[model samples]
Target: MTVLVSGGSKCGKSRYAEDIISKSGIDKKYYIATMQPFGEEAHLAIERHRKMREGKGFLTLEQYTDIEKAEISLQSAVLIECMGNLCANEMFSDSAVEDPVSKIVSGIKKLSERAGLLVIVTNEVFSDGIEYESGTMEYIKAMGEINSRISAFADVVTECVYGIPVAVKGDV
Candidate 1:
């Protein structure tokens, strides 16, 4: 099953997605940590997540980009902690900025095929009425496009509102 869970920051989307994978009864559980811990805040968040999964029997794979390239067994259940960071890494590279919609979408599709159960967590960053700068707007638009494409192919699409999982496309 392919599940996509999306919501605002700190809304329990990551925990919810983890639960989905943990309860699936799959022996090989993998947590694909997509965030590149570049600074103090990112480091702290990563540590917190590590503590959360300390005893969950999950093998953490830190793949900042090209998720399709991550090696995994066919019987494994994978939880991708988020798309926002992944997208940013793909978009604003070290030398240049590029559109990441197709690359991210394609990579995720390939990952879904390889894993027994795939749960993807994404952020809800579009609801705010304020307009952003050109670069930020590009990111928002790219995220929307990528999410739409993934949600179309996902078996379950859930939105976490105030830590409550609400089904957007399929049962949570």
Candidate 2:
């Protein structure tokens, strides 16, 4: 089964995704950490997430990009902590990878092929209704497109609002 959990920051989407994946009855749970720590805030957030998953029995795979190449058991359940960071890393990275959407979607498909259950966490973007710079706008557009594509194929699509999950598609 594939699930997409999305919402604003601190909306409890990550916790919800973790809870569902942990109870999935899959013995091998893999947490694919996609965040790339670049600054103090990033480091602190990474530490916080590490602490959260300390006892969750997840073998962490720090794949900032190219998630399809991540090595894991075929029967393992995979939880991709987020798409925002992954997208940013791919878009603004030193590499010459073109079209972040295609790259990410391909990786997701590959992971789905390899894992038993795939749970993806993404942030809700373009909700502020404020004009951003060209580069930022490009990112927002990319995220919106990526989320739409994922939701289309995901078995479950949920929006976490104030720790409450409002189902947008199939049930989790």
How do the residues 1-172 of candidate 2 rate in per-residue lDDT, one tens digit apiece?
8899999989999999998898898999999999988899999999998898888899999999887788989968999989999999888889837788988987887788788899999999879999999989999999999899988888999999999999999996
* lDDT values for all models: 0.90, 0.90
Best by lDDT: 2
Q: Pick the candidate with the highest TM-score.
A: 2
Models 1 onward score TM values of 0.96, 0.97
What residue pairs are clashing in model 2? none
* Clash count for each candidate, listed in order shown: 0, 0
Candidate 1 regions with alpha-carbon error over 4 angstroms: 95-98
lDDT by residue for model 1 (49-147), tens: 999888999998989888778888896999998899988888887834354788789889998998999999998989898898898999899999989
